[model samples]
Target: MRIALFFALILFHFSSISQSTDERAIREVLAQQVECWNEGDLECFMEGYWKSEQLVFIGSKGLTYGWQQTLDNYKKRYPDKSAMGILSFELIIVEPLSEDFWTVIGKWNLKLNSDNPNGHFSLIFRRLGDEWVIVSDHSS
Candidate 1:
């Protein structure tokens, strides 16, 4: 019985450590994304997403499939620095779906000289090797 209890404690400790690490990683990924946007590098900001054909993005226009198409849409919509402006995210929730997946809900805003656009977003990130990349995104 004591042996079982000891193993349980170890497992709990490991799980707690992993949760903490994942939280930090998620924050870092978000920060990097914001930094890329602030620098007006849409391509760099897209690095946070899964670069696969099966990646999905949903917006007011409907669903867009493929990573390249998503990037293209962003490029078309933002156009220039005036459109991209400075970006910020207010994280509402970041929950682990599993050991290798996380779901994030947040508010995103772009601050521009003439206008500030704000929207809510839901993102799902999958652990790909050592990195966490967004596999699916829905923003409105």
Candidate 2:
């Protein structure tokens, strides 16, 4: 019984470490996205998202489905570097839903020459293979 308890503690320790690592990785992805956006590289910005047809995004306009569609929408909305602006994020919560899924709640801001647009976002990230990517996003 003592041996079993020891093994369980070991497993719990490793799980906690793994969870912390995963959370850091997710935060890095978001940071990279912000860097890409600030550089006015939409393609690079999209790299943080799941490149799948099942990906979903909800914005001020409405709900958009698919990776290509979302990229297209971004391109159309922010046509130039001036419109893309400098992006930043303030994360509120990063909660693990399961071993391979997480939910993030945050606020995003875009500072442009004329105006700064800011909004709150909730994102669902999934571990697709070895990398974590945003599978669903709802921003307003």
TM-score of each: 0.96, 0.97
Tens digits of per-residue lDDT, candidate 1, 1-140, equal 99999999999999999998998898899999999999989999999999999899999999999999999999999998778999999999999999999999999998999999899999999999999999999999
lDDT of prediction 1: 0.94
TM-score of 2: 0.97
Estimate every model's Cα lDDT from 0 to 1: 0.94, 0.95
lDDT for position 35 in model 1: 97
